[model samples]
Target: MDVALVLIGLVGGVITALSPCILPVLPVIFLSGADRERRPYPVVAGLVLSFSLLTLLGAALLAALPLPPGTIRWAGLVALVLLGIGLIVPRFEAILEAPFARLPQARAGRDRGGFVLGLVLGTVYVPCAGPVLAAITIAGATGDIGAGTIALTAGFAVGTGLTLMVFALAGRAVSQRVAAFRRRQRAIRVASGVAVVLLALGLTFGVNVPNYATALDHEFQRLLPAHVPTGSDVPPALAECVGQALYTEPPDESQDCGPAPALTGITDWVGTPVTLAGLRGKVVLVDFWTFDCINCRHVIPHVEDWYAKYHAQGLEVIGVHTPEYSFEHEIAGVRRAVAREGITYPVAVDNDYGTWQAYGVQAWPSLFLVDAMGQVRHVAVGEGGYDETENLIRELLTTP
Candidate 1:
């Protein structure tokens, strides 16, 4: 799954480079090779490194901090505008370069200068945020600074860098062959600079890039294979009968795990409560979910199906809605989301996390299968484990 996600990021980066918004900046790749005397690798390396680092940092900050969506967009736009001005007017470059004048001017000064220029261009040339990029950003926003996130970001940067390197090499060949290109280099720079400025303006003024990106992303997702597991293979223990040991190693019956915690601190209840003692004869599946969580949303259909299939057979599904964002705390928001998602099952809004902490929940979309005796018999986190979870549910439902 991580590999697939990384591949998606790589493909997304390639697609983004080919998009209309990025076309203007494609020409900027030639700048690295303009001075054939200096090697282009330093500039290329700088661009890739800067872009990747900045992307990771941006994602981390967005996830950790509650920043307005428009803030980053506006800042990027301003930076691009200033860069465009610097490119079109050589005089402006002097003003911009003043801050970095203290650096030593040795034999590698030109290479260092090229690197700095590439860094600036890389930072300013943000592609339209497509689904893959959005996923990476969301992971970052959710405080998931794991290897998967890093891999995705690195894959994207590499894809963009590979494309840019090709363009740079091709431009270098053209510059060497065509005297006209060399003679009119300034004109090309000004034209590309103007194009970048226009692109930035379009983003700042809302050109509906997100809508287009979403449509494109959906089309791409359709091409990929389904990653989630289905409950086609159920274990014999869960499939056969109730009152049977659900696991090879049974839980310590004498431990006295206590009655299931009351559904406390719930801001809204979608249906009647299914308390531990009240539902003693029935099996219960407690789901920790948030409306906005993608993983949680993915498992909803399966959960709903289980409720529909087994509700009449002494099976109960309870959703504990624990919010990750502040906006989700509002009862109206959760209600609207529930309606939008067509969730008919009973849902308890854990606004204060009373239930979350009681269960020692750590992630969204966690499931706990409680037997008819009101003891937690099974647990699963994140996505997948469909067969195991549903089997446990069946076993509990069948227990006398």
Candidate 2:
């Protein structure tokens, strides 16, 4: 269903929406009532709507604008640092004293002024929540279009609104339990401060970089043969080097396939072993994949079609699930991913990456073609090679 792009968008949205920065400021909206009389709904609604709309714009800009990939991350980081510095000195006196702090007072609880009110409040709220919002917007820029931006905006609004609703309804309940709220507030402030700093760190160091999937895709594209049977006439040294850098290693006759490592399963999840040895005498193809990787999802259809066509002719496909994220380690999540993807082949959980390391695989959706003798013959990392892979399978199955 072309879920990769959508999922990326959804995740980007949710990440920004659920940020700690947005959560704490929601109380301010209700508290601005001075004497606190049923905290006006329009104010809260307007704030969420405006923030969501702003994020949507940010996402659209990200999609339309031709900016460097990491620019958003850096911007988000800087914004966060500035936010943290402001929070450390929350007094207006300190801000007013600064040479550049000539910002005027924001009209506190006026929500009935229509679009201008929404725009003004949203703009003013930026100083309070800008760091996190910027980070989310920056993240949206990593995708192809407004998908990431819209998803993040929607997710943020939902998350923030959900919490605000709870707080709004239970404001009196919360007020009575001021001690608990204060404790929670303290924890929240600490978390917000930490999140901003972490964002800065991630931007500075390029953490969770988006190169893994694209890098693998490019690697696969490079291996396409110029002519059938006779691959590229490129020098062996360059090919070997490229292969080593992309995959785990190049096929070497003298190099042992190594002692087959003991496959480790995810904790608390028990599943039967689906190994190449179990399907011996059949043309076996093992796909080393992770659920979170975008490039891996792109080539699933080709693999599925190839497996269906060749299965009756002594062909066996096994999926080795080596997760890249902590959440992917969950057996239920893995099962869900497998089901949603409509994967019929036997899947082995390589949560510890034992199989990945054994085969020297470094990329998701890496394919290893094993001949009937269980010898590794062809390795394709990241997609393509449908015809080549099919021919190889047909050759192995038909040989004897």
Top-scoring candidate (lDDT):
1
Full-model lDDT for every candidate: 0.61, 0.48
**lDDT accuracy of residue 190 in candidate 2:** 41
Which digits, one per residue and each the tens of the lDDT, describe model 2 over residues 1-400? 3343334333333332333333334344333222132233544566568656544454445446676422443444465455444433435213523542343424322223212222323432321122123334333332323444355455556655555545545654554467664545444444434544554554343232222233333443244321111113333432343254343333432211322223344333223556556666887777877654445666676788888988988888878887543335567767776776778887788755555545545345677777777766666665455676677777778877
Clash list (residue pairs), candidate 2: 13-151, 13-152, 17-156
Q: Estimate the TM-score of every prediction.
A: 0.48, 0.41
Clashing pairs in 1: 63-141
Task: Return the top candidate by TM-score.
Answer: 1
Q: Give the number of colliding residue pairs in candidate 1.
A: 1
Error of 2 at 336 (Å): 0.7
